[model samples]
Each structure stands twice: as C-alpha cells, then as structure tokens.
Target: MAVDDFNRADSNDLGVNWTESDYSTPNSLRILNNRLRMGEANGIAHYNGTFADDQYVEATVTGMQFGDGQTGIAVRVSGSQGGFSAYAAILWPVSGRVRLYKYVSAWIVADAQVELANVPYTLLTDGVLQFSTVKIAAIGATIKVYIDSVEVISVSDNSIASGNPGLIARSSYWVELDDWTGQSLSYDITADAVTNGSITPAGVTSVVGGGSQMYAITPDSGYGIFDVLIDSVSVGAVSSYNFTNVAEAHTISATFGPLMGQRALLKIRPENCGHITINDNSPQYWFQHGDNIVIEPVPDAVYALKLYVSDFPDAALTTGEPDSLPDEFHSCIVDFACYALSMKLKKWKQAAKYYNIYVKNLTQRRKDYIDRKAEKRAIHQIPNNIKYGGTRQ
Candidate 1:
C-alpha cells in the first residue's frame, strides 16, 4: 500500500498512530471535513512511524489566509522532548511563494523559495481562501519539490535521511489538509554509466506503482550509446526508455563507446561592441528587445569621463525566451509593440485594435497554460495504502 487518506471522523484518534507534537496546544489540531485542520497555535501533527530513506510525502492544504502564516508537510523528522527537527515544504500565501525550510529547536530555517504564478488560483471565496498541493520527494541526497503538480525545485542534501513524517502550521491560520499520504517503497533502483555516458531518473529508487520513471541516456562529447541494460539484461541501445506503471524494482545501466573516427569541433567568435557606458539609474545593464536605452545622466564632473561597460547579450524573441511575461503569451509581443507604436503616432483606431488583440491573446494564453498545468497534476497522483503505526494502535 502506498497511500493514506484521513477521511474518518476518528481520523485524529491515537489508535491510528497520529500524534501531535508536544509543542502543539490541545484541540488546536483536529480532523474536520475528512481533513486535518489547524487553529491559532503553531503546531505539527506527526505520523508515528519510521519510514525508509527514499520516500515521498504530500498533502493538499486549503482555507489558507494571506498573512504571516504558513502550512505544509514535514518529513524525516527526528528529535526529542526539548528539540525536534525536520524539513518542511510550505505554501506561504503572504509572500506568494512556496518555501522549503529546515526546522530545528522550534525555529524554521529557510532552504529554498520559488515565486508562485500570479494567476488567480482556485479560491472558494472572494480573496479569503486559497489552496495548494505540496509534495516532497526524497531519494538518497536528492530532494525534489512539486506544487499543484508542477515540479518547482530539485536540491541535494543528506543531513537528515530517515525519520518520521508529519504536517506543520504556523500561528493564527486555519489550514485544512486532505489526501495526506506517505509510502515506504519496497525496492531500490540504481544506475551506473561507463565511458562518458549518463542516465537520469537514475538516483530515484522509491517510485510507487502507477508512477512512470523515465530514463534518459546522454553520452558526453566524442561518445555514442553502445549498449543499455536493465537488471543486467540487454534492452538495446536506445537513447531513452520509459518504465510506465512501474510496480517492481529494477537496475538500469548505460555504456558509451567512441564515435566513428574524430569529429571536427566548431567555434564562433564573441560579439564585439564599439563602445560602452555606465548608467546607475538603470535597474540592470542588460537591455532586452524594445527596451529604451537612456543616454542622459545627471552630470558629476569628477566621474563624468569614467566609463564602465559589461558584455551583455541582447534578449532574443523565441519560444524558449526568458522574460517577465508568461511564456505561453510570448506570441503577443508583436501586438503589444505595435499598440505602443500606434499610440505614439496618435493613431487611435489602430492602437485600440492592437491593444484588444494583445489583451485577447494574453487572456487565452493564460487559460491554455492553466489547462496544461492542470493536466500535469493529474499525471502524478499520490499512491495509496500508506500505514501509520504507534504503541497506542
């Protein structure tokens, strides 16, 4: 069994081995709506069991208010009466970001943070409630994070490898959790490459059933895929393999041999600029497409002659271009630029048409992006049949 759902009225009963932290206040944490809800006090509800090193823990939290509050999941927790420690992946509504923290001595320590999309997330009420699905996957020293089914962060840390699993919340927030699940995988999968080749999804071993594990074989320069093996059995020399609905443990290995003869290397000269200038008023030195470059600066006689320039590449307009605007709406760049140009030329009708096109494109792109993200979430559903054990049970 790989999943657990707290959907019963007595879900909080100790008989199920669900225990609150010694620091949590009585009645501050309870089961409601078949989900765990936390009240005003900062608290942690721990499942009293020891899980393996490679495991995944996740929960869906809702009814979170936007203030100095956070709610999330804790894994690999270890400590005693005076001090307890664990790694927490939290949804911080106030900051509009998801953060990973290492908690020790009752203090939360920041590890990593990523900003959330500005789109209006699914909300039950008008600006009063927001929900998020937070998941943490730990395999050996590598830790991967996912929010609402989107993979956000992947880090490596081996400080705390194995311990108990639980939930965490800060003060003055009412947070509800559902589909809280933890699984202890049975088998370990590993991979090794010889002669300048690499494999991915290699380090991960505790994948649950119905989960798809993709293995990508990448060879270094001057090498080609020679052979691929699964559990020492030949699986041909394919560049990639997908193990869908993985239900058993297996070992994968790839080997790379030399490419035919010697391959010529190609190189290109760097771009050269005629001159450079320094502008303190500008937020950044790198200019993007259509960005206005200002030449005027307040005169300071002593520093006027000094010039400092940095080599910055011009931003490109492409499918994979990185920009402040969402990637899906990158196609509207032309419409937006045309709208601005029309306004400058005092062409009211042309400006309005371009503006409307830009708005419509942006709105439709946002909807499409949201829909694609929703599909990604459905692909990684948490496994079922998780068990929590304690002395009371």
Candidate 2:
C-alpha cells in the first residue's frame, strides 16, 4: 500500500532522465529524455508517466549551482485548464534557506513562505556542486513537496488542470539536469534466504526444557545467532549479520527473552550484511497481528513474503487427555483451535487440523445406543404384541 515508506534501490524501477515534449516542433519544446529543460517564459513540465491528472512527482538532483535566474522542480502540473506548484528554489542571495512558492491557475497562493535552514550543505554552490532532491505527491486538492526526505510545503489550486511535467530553467541559467533520486533507486528481491520463521501470539516456544519456560522467535534452519527477542527484550542476541547455513537459506530462531513472566510484543528487523542496510531509512510496518513487522525499501522495490507460524494461539487446545466429548460447560474450544478455524475460513494455509469434538461426541453416543439395543435382542425376541420363546420338549 504506498510502498510502506522504505524506498529500496533495485534494477527494475523508474529513474531521473525520466520526459515530455512536442516532436513536431522539436525546437519549440523538447524532452531530451525523461527530463524537461524548458526555456522562455513560464515554461512548465510534467512527470506523469501515466499521464494521469493526479499523481506525485519527486526528483533528486546532485551538484546544483547557486546564483541563477531560477532553478526548481514544478508540481500540481496539468493542462492549460488548471494547475498548482510546490517547488524549491535557490533564490539568489538566499542560499541555504529553502523557500516555497505556490499558484492556482493564474492566481498566486500564499502560505507564509516557510524555510528550513538546518542542513547547510543542502544549498547549491556557484552554478555547480548543488545537490537537492524534490518530491511532490498529490494529497487531495493539494500537492506537497518533500526536499530530500523532509516535508517542505503543500500548495492547492486548480490551474493548468492537467499537463506534462516541466523542469524549467526560467530566465538566464545553467544547471546539470541529473537523475532524480526518488525514481533512481528501485529493485525487487529475486531470492529470499529466510528459513524457518515463526511467531507465537501468547509467547515464544522453547525446544529445550528446564530453562525458565521462555518463548522464542527462531530461524531454525540457519546457524546465525538468529537474534531473538520479544518487544524490546533480547531473546537471543547474535552478534553478526550474515545468517547462513552455507548449505541452504538461513533460518532465524527466537526463544522467549528476559520477560520475567510476562508476554512481550515481537518485532523483527533484518540485519543481513548484504541484505539489510542495518541503518535503513526505509519505512517499516507491523505484522498482520501488528506484532511481527516486515520492512523493505520504499518508493523503489517491493518484496513478497509470507509469515509461517506454528503454534497459533487460538488453535492451541489444552495439553491433556482428549477433551470430553461434546463439552457442555465450556462451549469455547482452545485458543489455538479457534485461530486454526479462522485461518481455515480465510484459506490461509494447508494443514490437517479439522476436528470438531461436538460432532465426534454426537456420533459416539448414537453408536452406543444401537449397540445396547442389539445386545438385548440377541438374548430375547419380541414379535409385535407377543413374546417369542424356545420350543417346549
């Protein structure tokens, strides 16, 4: 849904150099590639690869030079009917201060120009060495700008209703139209190495006994620490990143951590040296139960993974003699049992665990009644209103 925040760089994704133009009048207007380097008055650009009226446009430019007539990315771009703008400008003399400007159709829209002067290096140098990333995503009637991962401003209007994207070099200017970072990095997972991954709703489970009844999250197939934990407590704190069986994919295993007799929330963050950035800035999300989370790079790559769990809490029946048939006092089945039912209804997995004690008991009672009647008939027989007896001497 929205790339889950983290943007990973992969092979098959969009890139800067990403374009629009009029081929008939190549000189009148041109798109050298996927970029719009416009000249003349109020030249506009659009990056709607989908050509859709509403969408987000983000770009990353490195090595930008200061002291130019005008240099910035445009947004809320549409046709001659309606449009809007959310751009970052290197307004001469105002170097490090990020400024915002907006317009609706032909009307100027104002939001008390805001500036972010914190990251000084964010400024552009003498018509060179200026690097800045811009992003504009449509959120309702407004288009917002995020300069290098930071939200700067949002503008709302209905001018130039829809059109192509334009990276205007308004007035006298010279700038390196480089790759847009937002679209530059994109890739997908060709192979996954996570082996044996499971989660417990109530708590982790242990394969070994005589050790504090701790629960766990483990990658049973791999030989790494498989760093285990619940909530923030450390279950099995492995000190390395490369989890490999060297023979097959790695499996991470987790045993209950130092909970001191309490259930903890399970959180998983990948740390494989080549697999995870360790300090990945990408977005993260919680598990289906909102406990275990799977994170990936954002706006670039997507990965498909399934959560395979063993002891589903609701499906767990009491560990004792087979429960009495057709239990009356307790209408509710064991916790795991309920969960298994839910999974079945949703068609989530394939398991042989479909047992209804109520039905089994009913069948057994019916059979018992028939057996008693047959035994009595073998000893004696009754014919309608009369009794049948053995023949007399």
lDDT of each: 0.55, 0.33
Q: What would the per-residue lDDT of candidate 2 be over residues 1-393, giving only the tens digit for each residue?
A: 011111334311223432322212222222333443333333434454433334444555533334434455554443431233333333322355444444344311123223322233345445454445666554335555666777766565443344334443344443334443222111111112234444322222222111122233333432222245323344333322232112111223343222122221223221110011113333322222223322222211222321211112222112342223234313323422443332222222211122223223322332343346543111110111111111101
**377: Cα error in model 1, Å:** 84
Q: Write the per-residue lDDT of candidate 1 for residues 262-340, one digit (tens) a residue.
A: 2211111112111112323333334332332333212111111111111224322125322255555567667666754
Q: How many residue pairs clash in each candidate?
A: 4, 64
Cα deviation of 248 in candidate 2 (Å)? Answer: 27
TM-score of 1: 0.44
- The whole-model C-alpha lDDT of candidate 2 against the native structure comes to 0.33
User: Which pairs clash inside model 1?
Assistant: 2-384, 3-384, 3-385, 3-386
- Per-residue error at 148 for model 2, in Å? 9.1
Write down the TM-score for model 2: 0.32
Model 2, runs deviating above 4 Å: 1-38, 51-68, 79-81, 84-96, 100-166, 169-393
Worst 10 residues of 1 by lDDT: 384-393
Return the lDDT, model 1, position 113: 23
